[model samples]
Target: MKFCYACGSPLIMKDLEHEGEVAYCEQCRQYRFPIYHSAVSMVVLNPNEDKILMIQQYGKKDNILVAGYINQKESAEEALKREMKEEIGRSILKQRFMRSEYFPKTNTLIWNFAVVIDSEDLSQVSDWEVDKAQWFSFEEAITQVKPDSLAQRFLNNFLQEYKIKSKDFFA
Candidate 1:
């Protein structure tokens, strides 16, 4: 940030253990750490853990898992449920914490969650954020999905956990 949020003075870089070098306001004697936006990416799986939900956002060709940034006062689970409802009109029946990765391109730290919901209950939902959503089998996704992307890694991790042939991923 160019200016301090607490005071109207200019911000300077100061080393802080919480987040490395941070913006410091000399006038207010306050330090403001660079905030990384927290987002969640979910691999929505069917009850049988066979098919996975993939989505294509507007202006994007590659299909990706459902993702959204968490809002203030919202937990990771809440964000997951909200994104699912908004993107596919479905509710998560169960969820498991997967992993987290830092996305330098968006300055975001994405928390991955594996969620289970009845695929049969899914209804037709439309949103400006996404243009297409479909359930793809493990074989199909491993073959068609982008080889070098977070979505592929999430799929690989899921497959590995289920004792599926995860070695074939990106092979």
Candidate 2:
């Protein structure tokens, strides 16, 4: 920041007392302001219990799940639903908040959700943002996509949760 928000004085860079990071205004005793971005992701499962919906990225051509940024006046859940509709043209059945993580390296807060959808409703998938949409078994999805994608992470978590929930229900 060039000017201090609290006081309209020009900011000067200097080392902070406790933290090594540089401060914005040393004379006015102001610290540097950090900005964070919000992102939303969805883990969508099919009714057949055999496949998960994945989108082939238009830019990278790699398979990924439904995810996007939260708009100016949108909630995390709303953003996920909007992204799903815009990318795949399908409506989600049931959704539950899964987990959230902050990536300091990217200054992004990622909100993830697990959603269940009917397999028969994949007829009107969109191709504007995504090149193609396909359903893959858990094992096939994990092995086929890029290792560091959000889809892989969601699949791993979904599998773990599914196993635990199924075991508890059965036992």
Index of the highest-lDDT prediction = 1
- What is the Å distance of residue 92 in model 2 from its true position? 1.3
Model 1: ten consecutive residues of lowest lDDT: 162-171
Estimate the TM-score for candidate 1.
0.79
- On the 0 to 100 scale, the lDDT of residue 24 in model 2 is 83
Q: lDDT per model, in order?
A: 0.80, 0.74
lDDT of 1 by residue, 1-171 (tens): 688877779999989876888889999999976668999998788777668888888778787888899999999989998988887888888787878998888989999887887564545555677787878897887876666998888877876765654333212
Cα error, residue 123 of model 1, in Å, equals 3.2
Q: How many residue pairs in model 2 have overlapping backbones?
A: 0
TM-score of each: 0.79, 0.75
Each model's backbone clash number? 0, 0
